[model samples]
Target: MKNDLERAFEEARRRDAIELEWLGASIQGRPTFAEAELLDRRGIPSCHVWKIPRNEAPVHLTAIDALRRWQAGACAMCSASPRRLLVDHCHRTGLVRGLLCTSCNTAEGLQSAPSFVAYRERPPAVILGVEEMYGSPWGEEIAPSDASPEERTQRNAAHVDAAEGLFAGITDRFRPECADG
Candidate 1:
């Protein structure tokens, strides 16, 4: 009974051969060429062509499924095979702490906390209204000039204030509850 299901899963994986990673960002997205090469060299075992993680890696599931799993508060660390069941960072940062199991994260922590920490902290975390941010999606953008310190500080302050105002009014845009009563 189970063998047939396992066989089918493997067959599907083989069919999806072009993509080595389906669950998260591809190797190219790793911070630097050195980083990508490092991950490649280390050999991400669970992402092997033939073997699937013992407990399924929820890479391709729809939002509803992911949400359900998240709301249920499933253990961030794998309950079954701790090593394979790591809570992989969606962004591989400490602040985001989205996917991986506890053990894998701890293992990586020994290597460098910043790399892991960056995963948990979402990029462009600054919320400027529901639609826009003062900073670009990648965060800080250099204007390509050696502007004076005073000028730079003033520009930054204005940007931050604009972003705050944008986000602040976001709540009002969605639910205008104050007027009813």
Candidate 2:
């Protein structure tokens, strides 16, 4: 029999594929490249994609799903039990940070407040060993309590830099505006 973790992983993979497909179709019908670029510039993910980390085990979609379950389907920041929780990840590393309800997620993206920074630095998944069960997909778990102030500042800066580069590769794919002949 599959364990809860295994089952969650399987389900996450399935859901991830479905979401990607839906996003692909939805984006094809809209001029969202500009919007995506804007969001990326602000360190807010316009869309979620699963990326394999260099020299590390990939964090599967299951981790996010498992985290959602672990958090009891509530916003990690405000503890509001919303019907659907959005996966909050590091825009730079694509690491699964935590799950948040829509309100908190939106506010965090806009403000980048200290609470969100603290939450990401030591996500509950890393603290409670939920990530370890999934092969520590975050590479090395840096407990917020253990990281020096400098390290945290540097990490946050890296996230900003990476977000600026996130949509760089896709710029060429967007169609340019047409001019009247």
Each model's Cα RMSD: 16.3, 14.9
Q: How accurate locally, in lDDT, is each candidate?
A: 0.36, 0.52
Q: What would the per-residue lDDT of candidate 2 be over residues 1-181, giving only the tens digit for each residue?
A: 9999999999988877654543333223221445534544554342232121222222453565555534545456665566788776664343567777787788877876555555666665554344422112355432243456676557656655665587655654563643234
Query: Candidate 1 residues 1-181, lDDT tens each?
Result: 5699899998778745523343223222223334433443454222221112223324554333332233123222222223233333222111122334465456655644443333333211111001111223446532212546565556556655776798876766567674455
Model 1 stretches astray by more than 4 angstroms: 1-113, 116-144, 171-181
Predict model 2's lDDT versus the native. Answer: 0.52
Best by TM-score: 2
Off by over 4 Å in 2: 1-61, 131-181
RMSD of 2: 14.9
True lDDT of residue 110, candidate 2 = 81
- How far residue 52's Cα lies from its native spot in candidate 2, in Å, is 28
How far does residue 140 in candidate 2 sit from its true spot (Å)?
Answer: 23
